[model samples]
Target: MMERRAYPLRISAVVLDAMQRWSEDELRSLNAQIEFVLRDALRRSGRLRPPPADPMDDTDGD
Candidate 1:
């Protein structure tokens, strides 16, 4: 397992509200949804490699 670190983040209420809405749309936890968005942006910017397929995507085909 990869080591995970927890750090406090300060975000505006409006941004947090938007993230909450987006998380519900994607059926993901709010924190996971934020991470997903950040990872995608990183990959697009060439700062990170593409991530593995999302397990959540499989649910829609069932």
Candidate 2:
């Protein structure tokens, strides 16, 4: 499992409320939703590389 680090964030109330609503709609916790959004943005901007596929997760016939 990937390890997580705690970091304090100071976000505007308006944005926080919007993100909370979005998280509820997606059935995800606020922290997960925020990380998902950040990861997506980083990948889209070519600032983050996709994690290597886990060999143990392979299910296709080989």
Candidate 3:
């Protein structure tokens, strides 16, 4: 399991409401949804490395 660090975040009311709605729709807790968005943005911007590919992946037409 990954170690999680807690921190304070100051979010606007409108953004928090939107995040809550999104989290409900996705069936994830508010915190999980927030982390999901942050991780996705980081990966897309190349600030974070993608997870290692699965070693047993054999979907390629070999």
- Model 2 misplaced regions, further than 4 Å: 53-62
With candidate 2 superimposed using the best TM-score fit, by how many Å does residue 2's alpha carbon deviate from the native? 1.2
Residue pairs that clash (backbone atoms under 3 angstroms), model 1:
none
> How high is each candidate's TM-score?
0.74, 0.81, 0.78
- Model 1: per-residue Cα lDDT over 1-62, one tens digit each: 34678878899999999999999999999989988998889889999965577766776756
| Separate clash counts for every candidate | 0, 0, 0
lDDT of 3 by residue, 1-62 (tens): 36789999999999999999999999999999999999999989999976778778888968
**CA RMSD of all predictions:** 7.1, 1.7, 3.2
Better of 2 and 3 by lDDT: 2
For residue 24, model 1's alpha carbon misses the true position, in angstroms, by 0.6
Kindly list the per-residue Cα lDDT of model 2 for residues 1-62, writing each as its tens digit: 87789999999999999999999999999999999999999999999977889989967976
The prediction achieving the highest TM-score against the true structure is 2
Q: How accurate is candidate 1 locally (lDDT)?
A: 0.88
In model 1, state the lDDT of residue 18: 96
| Model 2: ten consecutive residues of lowest lDDT | 53-62
